[model samples]
Target: MSLEVLQVSKQYGTQLAVDQVSFSARPGQVLGFLGPNGAGKSTTMKVAAGYILPDAGDVLIDGISILTHPIEASRQIGYLPEHNPLYMEMYVVEFLLFVAGLYQLHGAEARQRVAGVIHDCGLEKEQHKRIGALSKGYRQRVGLAKALVHDPKVIILDEPTTGLDPNQLVEIRALIRKVSQYKTVILSTHIMQEVEAVCDEVVIIHEGKLVAQDSLKALKQNTTEVVFVLETQEEMQSKWFDDLLGLAKCHLISPTTIRLEAKEVFLLRTELMQVLNSHGLTLISLRQEERSLEHVFYELTAPRYNV
Candidate 1:
């Protein structure tokens, strides 16, 4: 694993912002850190970056505990904070150079590093403009450029896509996806669609506690699957009674529609027809509904844990 967090928690007075959350990530994988606003996603990322100390537990990078070696851990992790802060008075290229200098690069090497990121992050045109003069999308690119200039192995981005236009969102997402080829990327976002767009696995926190950690597909599989609709006709429920008999799960909606699995649809309709005919029920319609990530996100994060 490139990174590991063991039982981490953060408390501000009586309020616990993060509680015993643990997970791992390696190069070539993007982990989505998902939760609602104020759900400790930012706190967790800050702790991982060594910007804030956890009240308990450990954060490690490549087997080295960050608490004991903040500099080494920081050298390995590139963090773009939730706000994407940049000095409004500084030009994009100048800011990149400053960040590069912090990483100990100098002379030609520093200039090359800054230039590489300017192109890599699509900040070429805005490179000479003061950050305060750039549009929100361009400014976000500068924030990302600074994070990438040092070539860190672990990238931690908090709501990296916020305030971006649709085209900019796609562009930035592509950039992140490309970088995942050689580094571990941890992204925090409430946009469920972005999770599907780039992340390989997802770790969800709710009320300062870990609630889910799994592949998106795996999470969906574990959630209950039920189709709900109006109850169909009585006569439809009686036909093919024996043939349509064994369904593992089925749900009836209001008195005219039926919701069922695709495999069971035909059999269910036949059997339901028989049952309906016997009981004077009439069938109106039937349909299929599959669960979505939005539903699963809500389900996992809905419960409150009073940490």
Candidate 2:
């Protein structure tokens, strides 16, 4: 594993911000860290990046414990915080050089790395501009450039696309995918589309607890209830769908439209078609509803007992 959080926990006064949260990420994997506000995503990322100490447990980067060897662990990780802080007065290249210098890189090596990141992050056009004059998208690119300047093995980003417009969002997401080609990346974001677009695995935290963690495909496949929408020419009563095989529940959305819930949508489809044919009901349209990541997120994070 390139990164691992072993039973990590954090507390501030009486409230426990994080409670024994644990997860791991391997090289070349992009893990989406998801949670509602104040679910301790940021705190956990901070601990993983070695920016703060955990009250208990520890974080490891490439088998090195962050708590025991903070500097050494940090050297292998690149972190872009939720609130990106930068020297507004510094030029893009100047700032990158400054970050390179912190790693004790100098002369030709430092220049080369800065240039590499500038090209990799799509900052070549804006590299000579002052940080204060750049747009939010460009500024974000600069922050990402700074994070990648040292060629770290692990990358952590918090709300990386918080305020980006559609075009910027696509660009940044592409950059993240490019970076993950060789590094382990863990990013927290509320945008479900972003997760669908880039993340291979997802870790969801709710109330400072690890509610769920799995590959994106597994999460969708394991969903307990699969919904299907059907439209027909004739009106259908709620009781018409009650006896259908494999159906868990049914709802009459309109006189001619119905929604069916089942464990296996494929089975439900076949059974539904047979029933419709037997009853001579003309089927106008029938389709399996596509489940979105937002729906999965709510199902896991909702306050109700049944998930």
Candidate 3:
């Protein structure tokens, strides 16, 4: 199923949490919703999930408006909120079964789907344990299982990897990638690496406004300038790059690594070769970094964050 938010806006008392923000998600792809804290990502997802009504505009699930057809639209979405509300006293299996029942999945089908989801989410080892006993990572798995039990076409996740360890983070990222094959996954996060790791498309918000949205590859090279990481076999002084063609700035990131920024990457790369040859320095690696969301994010949202 496809999910589309059109000119959606929301307000809380005196603060405008979201202002005419719009974006989309398609099946078989992961669309990342990114923003600084309080940028209204959660608010937009909530409106799309039908948990709350928008002050203006609408959300459509497969062309079905969440506002006009709340029940039908909700039936098509599986949302895992930032906090991941779960009954701590309930066993993992029991909680999933309870959730399945809410959607009217009964008898053999409920049991089968619960079993399948447990296995899919890698919750088999901890299925019989109470939710309170599971660590945060496993708890997250259980929450994901809950979201999938209904077999919804669109899965909306809000900061699902917030507090995971590195190992758990990788596992969850893999699971997200695995699930997106047949489901429209809208993942909300502040971590740029997470977006780089799994997202096909990106939507960035800043101060409750939509700032940028595009394919991950397109957004990566969208900025006017590009950064290159130059590493040498021998440690070099920053002054060696002085008067380099259109070199905006240079910083020593490591003994053998220097980060360079320029308006035109081609010019910088060409001059870098000449400069290295002039210094008799053997270049280990000099390549344009593929990472872009970090630079794009801070550039667009710096006012709210860097203040």
Candidate 4:
């Protein structure tokens, strides 16, 4: 594992910010860290980056414990915080050089690394401008450039694309994907599309608890309820599908269209075909509905409604 968060917990006064939260990320893997506001996402990321200590448990980067050896662990991690704070008066290159200095990078090596990040983060056009004068999109690029300037093995990005426009979102997402080829990336974002676009796996936190963690494919497979849309040539009553085998429910979408919810999709598909054949109903179309990441997120995080 490139990054391991072992039973981490944090508390503020009487409130438990994180309760035994644990997860790991491997090199070249992009993990999406998701949660609603005040769900301890930032606190966990802070502990992972060695900026704050967990009340219990530990975080390790490349086998070095963050709690015991923060400096060593910090060397292996590049963090872009939610705010992306930067000095407004400083020139973009100057700011990067300053970050490079924090890593004790000096002379030709520091210059080369700064230049490399400038190119890598698509900041070449704004490298010479003052940080205050750059657009929000370019400012975000500068923040990312600073994070990558140290060439760390693990990257932690917290809401890195929060305020970006659609074009900027696309560009930043591409940059994250490019960097994940060689580093372990933990991206914190509320946007479902971002997770789908860049993450290999997803870890969801709800009320400071780990609710779901798995590959995108596996999560979908495990959590998705199979729904099928059926269109017939002739109108049919909704009750016609109420007796179908393995069906959870049926919806009357239109006079000639019905949507079926099934407990077992594969078995239901075959059974549906048989029923249609026996009834001599002309099937216009039948297809399974693909669940979106947004749906999964809501399902995992939403408050339960009692029947």
Residue pairs that clash (backbone atoms under 3 angstroms), model 2: none
**lDDT by residue (tens digit), candidate 2, 119-170:** 9999989999999999999999999999999989999999999899999999
Error of 4 at 211 (Å): 1.4
lDDT of 3 at 217: 89
Q: Who is ahead in lDDT, 2 or 4?
A: 2
From the highest lDDT down, the ranking of the candidates is 3, 2, 4, 1
The residue-by-residue lDDT of candidate 1 on 84-130, one tens digit each, is: 88999998888889989989999999999899989888888889999
Error of 3 at 33 (Å): 0.4
lDDT of each: 0.80, 0.88, 0.89, 0.87
Which of the two candidates, 3 or 4, achieves a greater TM-score against the reference?
A: 4
What CA RMSD would candidate 1 show?
Answer: 6.2
List the lowest-lDDT window of 10 residues for candidate 4: 298-307
lDDT of 4 by residue, 161-254 (tens): 9889999999999999999999999999999989999999999998889998899888877333687878989876766666677787666666
Local lDDT at 25 for model 1: 84
Cα RMSD for predicted model 3:
6.1
Worst 10 residues of 2 by lDDT: 298-307
Q: Estimate each model's TM-score.
A: 0.80, 0.81, 0.81, 0.81
* Residue 128 alpha-carbon offset, candidate 2, angstroms: 0.9
